[model samples]
Target: MFEQEYESFWKAQVRNASGQRLEMLQRDLTGTKKLLEAVLLPVLGSLDDLILEYEMLSVSGMKIYAVVCLPRLRTVFEEDSFVTHAEKITRDRFSFERVRARSVAILGYTYFPYSRDELEKKASFCQRNLFELIGRVGNVEGTGMNQLPVYEREVLRFAVYNRKPFQLKDVCEWLQLRKEACRQVVRELEFKGLVNAVGGSATRCHKFMISEKAVALLHRS
Candidate 1:
């Protein structure tokens, strides 16, 4: 469901120790994705919904260009643009300027410390929201999303991670599903009351979000 083919991280890594060693720092990728998919997508849509910053990789102070996945907002933005993003965690991994060049909006930086206390201390508004989001990923309480089919779970996870309105085109591209098939999935979610369509009746029904009922239940989860 993570869609490795859609993930630039796995597409062209050397796979030897030199490349694989960086796996220890996967939180760089995961955390970035979480922030964008959850906190930043809404503002980003208003800025540049047509394109995205996608995945980034900086290793040992060297800028590494990765294979680009075109025409979508990718989850990861691996940059060390500020003290908050990488300098706080480690040095010589990425560049703030290079990452900015690829970005639509300049979101805040995030530092994921191994210590919960340290993390809780420096969590700016963005980081605090992201921290709560991380909690929701692996259910704090089993809310039955586990019972869903794999594809349904993927879309639901996207909705939950987004915590905001989204479009079928975005999810379809992000999840690598055919358009019609994704519509069917959304239809199922609407029936289950996990999702619902949103828009004026005069306008086309193009926007959707996690249902408020489901959101209320999930917050407690």
Candidate 2:
């Protein structure tokens, strides 16, 4: 029942939108979350079997991984560097750098036997299988060179016009590039102060809009 609910919640939360508006996005996320709780939890019976880790596999196929301990496990990595032999597994399995520094927590929960040992094992599972899972889940990575033409300009435009929070995936969908390509553009935009990512890669999806500076520069130009 909980598993089913979680699945419903997950699906409901994936509110796809375009044109990059903040209020609309907020509402979208809110709706998505509500949908998750209402539909997903009751259906899934448990959302607590796996840990979520985010990896930034660059356009060059270089990966940066971060483990996320959800709910109360938030601070697991705060005091600790959160590196382990599993870190090696992450690197080897994913073929990318394990960038624990920028990891962010997406959604995470533990299974019924929610013991510390179970949770740690789940964490270890994420530390190892995150990259692989991402691949299995249809999240593709592309190179900077493959990014949409005029992407930096588009990012600047989106930021200036939207004046709200956004995720890297939002930019990717807006620009029609993969997350890796989107990150490349976002890096350039950040350097130029055209846009910024509020949290680390774990919450890479959580973005606040910042385009006033870029808008001013565009007017000047």
Cα lDDT tens digits for candidate 1, 1-221: 33343264343332322443344333344443443343343323222221123334443333333212212212233323345554574444345534534442332222222222233343345544543453345243354455667677677666766666888897797579899999888888889887888884645677888775554443232
Q: State how far residue 198 of model 2 sits from its true place (Å).
A: 2.1
Off by over 4 Å in 1: 1-136, 139-141, 200-204, 216-221
Clash count for candidate 2 is 32
lDDT of 2: 0.41
Please give the CA lDDT of all the candidate structures.
0.48, 0.41
Top candidate, metric lDDT: 1
Q: Give the distance in Å from residue 22's predicted Cα in candidate 2 to where it truly belongs.
A: 43
- Please, what are the lDDT tens digits per residue for candidate 2 over residues 91-173? 46443322333232222322111123323345433322321221122111221211324677666555544545778877887
Which residue window of length 10 is worst by lDDT in model 1?
A: 66-75
Model 1 earns a TM-score of 0.38
